[model samples]
Target: QVQSNGTALVAFEKATGKVRWAIGQELASYTSPLVVTMHGQKVLLYFARGGLLAVEPRQGKVLFHFPWRARIEESVNAANPVVVGSRVLLSECYGPGSVLLDIDQQWQPRVIWSDAGKDRWDRSLAAHWCTPIYVDGYLYACSGRETPEADLRCLDYNTGEVQWVQKRTGRCTLLFVDRHLLCLNEFGTLIVLKPNPQKYEEAARYEITDLEYPCWAPPVLSDGILYLRGRGRLVALELIPSRK
Candidate 1:
């Protein structure tokens, strides 16, 4: 658990709720911690306010720390790090757009590519809060800080090259299931998209009635039911057709 003071991450025992280990004085960010296997070892990656902290899960020892944050005071590291094999991608809508880092054998981070230069819109991705989804060798995400500037874009994961952009999608969250992308925009509009790197290919769209705007929460899928939450409402829709 992240401390309320944003100064530490505490690990608690599941049954007794006892403190297991606490490490680092780095400020916490909204991005959640991710556990992945790297080089035949388990690594815990946390994108704190300072940057990405790679830690050993069992002993709570810090392995490596890479500084990757914006220069502004009000900026945040909201998007969770996207990891594929030995490389990890960190993205934000602030000054630093996105960076791809390659973690080598010694747990050292080396910059593969960075799009944190001029021409923000031309960068691969500048996601505000939604984490980019990795599929095959591409990335799919809504790139922008605000609603008016938001665009659903596809990018080459390795080279940080923009493949395609679907304009005016607004700030949205995505869920990939059954080889299809389920997008729920901030304005309560749900869109089904076929994941294609060459162009924007939408399969279907629906305006979820009675669901208010500012739908920042990502859609949840469970047992063939799609759950959507908006201001003052929670909706559940069945996606799989009944066999009857």
Candidate 2:
């Protein structure tokens, strides 16, 4: 297991807690590393403050690095990288917008396209910290700055085109399940909607009045139980289908 500070990555043995390897002396971002298989080998992708670094897990060898960060000094890359097929998708709310990188057979990375060239705030999907979920060749995520300005959007995964946007939804943490989106808003309202790019379709909604703080943590589902976190409490709700 590896842990990251604002600078440097330290890998330790899980059972013995001994240092196995240590690499990376660059500034770090809030995003965690994603272990993925690219080009038939397992590699760790770290979305650091300066860029994205692909590292060999066991040996801590730096494979490649892709620069991605906000031009503003205060902005940081806090979202994890999304891997699709042989490509990697990256987006953040701070700097420019999103970028797509294509990895070839030789493990070299190339920029397929980038939305950061557009007006900073006008990018297709400016995700703050919440990573997006890809469904049927499309991306569904909460896009915008924060709070009232945030919107739930569906965009073409390959083209980065906005297919539809649902406004006034507040900042949301989402989970895609069985072709549906489980959106938990900041106000603790849970909304179930179809993940349709053509239009907005609501299936059900429930407001958890006991929540004391904004539900910013991502909603997690396990064994038919949905778990959520608020200011000081954790909630688990059982998901049972309605009787026919």
Candidates in order have lDDT scores of 0.90, 0.84
Q: What TM-score do all the candidates reach, one by one?
A: 0.95, 0.91
Best by lDDT: 1
TM-score of 1: 0.95
lDDT of 1 by residue, 1-244 (tens): 4455533566778899977888887776899989999999999999888789998988788899998888887888899999999999999888788999999989999999998675876778898899999999999999999889999999999999999989988999999999999999999999999999989999999999969987889999998999998998999999997678
Model 2 bad stretches (over 4 Å): 1-7, 241-244
Off by over 4 Å in 1: 1-7, 242-244
In angstroms, how far off is 143's CA in candidate 1? 0.6
Model 1, residue 226: C-alpha shift (Å): 0.4
Worst 10 residues of 1 by lDDT: 1-10
- For residue 66, give model 2's deviation from the true position in Å: 0.6
lDDT of 2 by residue, 92-165 (tens): 88777788899887778898778867985568888888888888888888887678779989988888888988
Error of 2 at 235 (Å): 2.0
RMSD of each: 1.8, 2.9
